[model samples]
Target: MLIIPAENAINWKRPPWVTLGLMMACVMVFLFYQGADDRKLDAAIEQYLDGNLLALEAPAYEDYLQREIRFEGDQQSVLELQEFQALREQDEQGWQAVTLLFDRDYYQYLQDNRDLIWSVAERNQWSEQRGAIEEQWISRMSAFQLGLVPSDLSLYTLITYQFLHGGWGHIIGNLLFLFLLGFTVERALGPGKFLVAYLVCGALSGLVFTGFSMGSQIPLVGASGSISGLMGMYVAIYGLQKIRFFYFLGVYFNYFRAPAIAMLPVWLGKEIYDYWFAGATGIAYMAHAGGLLAGAALVWLLGKSWLQVKEEFFEPEPEQQDEQFTRGYAQAMASVGRMEFDLARRQFEALRENYPDRTVLLEHLYQLAKLRPDLPEYRDLARTLMADAMNRRQPEQMLDVWNEYLSKGEAHHPLAVEDHNRVLFTSLKNHDLKAAEKAFERMRLKAEPDMVQEACRLLLAEFEKLQMEPKARHYRQLLRG
Candidate 1:
């Protein structure tokens, strides 16, 4: 008989509803941030133009102005001067004239403000001090924000700073990381905890970006900071386990196992290497570092309970425990086969306690009980074994044992229905009316209709021989029914 393992029967499966809800929520948030970014671009154009710096760099400003003024327009020229001007004057009167003028004078605006865009901090001492102080306050306030730094820390900057992409390649890289790592972390930690972790990582990444690039006017953005944290948590929790990754490095699509603990260190090292030696043009390595740190710390804080939850919900069955029990039972049976009654009895008793439903174990127990029949304990053991057999729909087993006991004429034998009925039938068949009458009285108490009728017919015939006509008529009526 092939026994199916219980663990396989009850597979560890997660409910899809929770995952579905989280995915929907993340999509909605992404759309919201995208919308907010469009608004920030519009606001930045207006700020730049109102500052009267548009005239000197009018040609570049004009080019930025004509790109798009609405949400449906192309965001590819988001940083272009003409598009920026159009976005700024979108709600103003004579937007077409403003767009036309800015497009024409875009080159002049670039020439004038090229210095401001590149070195805004060095040119304006006040702006530098204010920006530095503002960033510092935001970083310090992070301890209280729990991950949500207020927008006033930087105007029109934080909006693009959160989602802006350095290039197509950079955005795609971050997106891939987010999709894979985010899904697993979200599923394991649940949406609420996952959200908290993401936000906190982002906040910390922002602080790191500010600290490392103090005077740089370059705006930071992308989900990389938060996604890095997820990677850290993944490594921490599944360090020993193999993670199947589909690598697309040029042509070869090979599968490999990354040692779980080593994943984070390797990732951090690459980010650091890129930051220092590879020109800080496309990616935010500092943000990745900050996010990784936050992710690792969060996991450390919640790792124990999370592990317990995973084990309780997803652990395989205790096959080892079952195997141990099977081994012990086999040894007990071997003892019984050798007629080591006492040792076999003890083992079988322990096995019965542990695995009460094993019918074969009870059968061996019955044999041991029979071997020590003179002991009062054996009599009780026999009753228990017979009752267990009956419960399991093995009445024939019980009947055999009862008949064996009766044949031995053991005074200590417990009265059983099968043995009682067997003796009653034998006495009645011999035509000893008085003995038959006594047996009939006892059997009538427990016998079904057919047995009662047969007994009554025999008794009636015997009573007729004794010339008891009234009793004979009564018993004949019972047989007719």
Candidate 2:
């Protein structure tokens, strides 16, 4: 029932509020406004089935099916009608097989041949019965006005229908799609633009469905139209870029990497195929296809100005990058062996530009920067190496590099509050109490109060072990704070 991108996990640093908010809105609308709709519709239908209206309409409903068998000239329709007739004959209480709705055409059929069908009094009674049923249909079902009826759609109902749903399965499936596609698109376009685009696509999907099903009384209700647009926008934003996709093909569900743009056509084809072959399955397949088109077109029109694609979401795994650069890395190391530091530095710098998180590369650059602190790039490499306390492969070397740079009277960039706390632990790992003491003082500025307290406790214990009374006493005073 769904295909979604599984490229990026949730980043707590940037929560997708707009996506969550939209999901909440859909759920709340269903609970508060649409919840009673099902019960009300059932009440009206129950009344129709229990009353004389069923006796009158049952034969007429059968006549409508017979006409389909005679005129439609299709094996599918004929087979379906034959099944219906067979089901009725097989069951004793079989008249219930004829399900009735607010079918104006069938009502008109009854009225036009009133003499053949019934007497004047009987016709009047039939009219009164259907009239009473119609009244119950319109008034009792609370969500009837909110749904987008194709024959009599209003501007207000066009958008409102998207928020309304038929039942639990419909709303749950739709919200899952909204969260999956909406977050990335929202992160790209931002909240305001994402909301605008979502509404526009939903409206367009309604219009597209109306174009096909105009003059039909059935109301279209669900967020699928809007969500389909998000699917389109997702592909458009990452066009031609290879990204991991999780797909389901009826019996199969699996993931593979492909250009994100390629999925748009595949998704469109599925919806169009279902529309052609599924045959009155109640899903608005055309609306889904239209929404996908509208979403892609909106992003394409806005171009880069509107869509800020985050490359990290679609980039290859680090192992793939490592494999790609292994030969280049060997060449750089060969240059280092030949004492061609300038050429080696150039090659490492090039590699760092693409994969900055490569720890071995950074360690090599730090070593190179030590050999040539006179160069302008040493300051950048030194700052980069020291700031990332997360690169825990070589903490002793990093502290030594930091010390040499500062001892030479070079200006130091301050560590971020969180990084400063991490570096405190890093300094202690190397048994550099003097450096840990400096890190402790730097962290005193604005690090988490809890982390600072923990650091004081740790320093007190470590210094006491070294029989350094003055350092231990200083930490004791800070811990008291």
Candidate 3:
């Protein structure tokens, strides 16, 4: 089954810088650094084929296979060798010849018996040609130079290999997965911690691949393992909380809501099953599984105390509510167009009752409230608008509503302490220091000590950054108090 999280609305308040950086790193490494990979590989292959290494090795491989009868996949090797022999007799080396390099066991066997089989001069010449080709390949190809090779694994390869990819399809597919899940994960984890988590998961994936494919010389590359880790963290972060997931089984596909953590078993089962039965299809299912486990465990062990989850990231899915309300919303707007103010207000108020958090409704209602500001309900409507307007647009202007509601006249404020806190912090986060300063001053007298202190520190830091010494000094004095 193919399963993935149904997307939540993106919070662009904090752009996923780490995610974009990673995607760009992979792309640049591929386009500029790895551009020579194809040409270098072709040159190495051509050198090997032209030097008659395959022809020289085929007979020796057949002989070795005849004697070494018990090894796994040796029978396939025998068939492959016979095919190579037949092709050689017809004066063609064929693509099978190049692939023989992947069968390291056979390649090693040929090395071990080279002296016994080939005449000394021919063997020495072939060995020299092979050594040159190997050097050319390892030096010129980014995959070989940087990729994670289990047999010759290094601390360096564990990280660099993640940025290397096999081809356009490979990089494109990996990057697509990165963008699909990376942005949300990065925001949930925060940029610095998210970057750390990504590297940790990626390194763990490389280690896992090395554990399973131990002693194989083939280089492992691509970002799938890490991206898989992200998938794990994504599901784990939302553990036990139910969210929509898109699942596909053969011809059937649909979305269903289930506890987020429930996906762990299903995902683990799929990857493990593929590893067991897929017969070395070249995809690293083991690494994917490892990344999934690593991310889940890391996040779980850290928990909220260490890696505090932004609960807002997993808020109730708004699309469903919006979809259901579409008709009523249109009708309400139509009423407004015909000057049916009372009808429109009732319709919007009804919709507001169902979706109090929707900004569009609150924004529209705020405008309507301004039309009847003398009414007591207008104050309540304005308060609600300031509350929801924090993330979407300029919340600074909403402070006008707060300023209008009281005898305080932007001096001591009139909002409930909680709304006051929201307005202060949101303005600070959005960098409207003027709006934030008003909110902060209003809140300092009315808000909790901790909120006041945090708001004070945040405002002080921003003013300091902008080199507003007087403003910074005033906030700093408030912080000391």
TM-score of each: 0.44, 0.69, 0.65
Candidate 1 Cα misplacement greater than 4 A, ranges? 1-26, 29-33, 36-55, 58-176, 305-309, 313-481
Poorly placed runs, candidate 2 (over 4 Å): 1-3, 74-80, 83-87, 90-98, 102-117, 138-143, 304-344, 347-366, 369-481
Off-target runs (Cα >4 Å) in candidate 3 are 9-15, 63-69, 73-94, 316-481
Evaluate model 1: give its TM-score: 0.44
Better-scoring candidate (TM-score), 2 or 3 = 2
- Model 2, global lDDT: 0.78
lDDT of each: 0.57, 0.78, 0.79
RMSD of 3: 13.1
| Tens-place lDDT digits, model 3, residues 302-326 | 8677677776665444566667689
Q: Is candidate 1 or candidate 2 better by TM-score?
A: 2
lDDT of 1: 0.57
Pull out the clashing pairs in model 2. Answer: none
Worst 10 residues of 1 by lDDT: 1-10
Sort the candidates on TM-score, descending order. 2, 3, 1
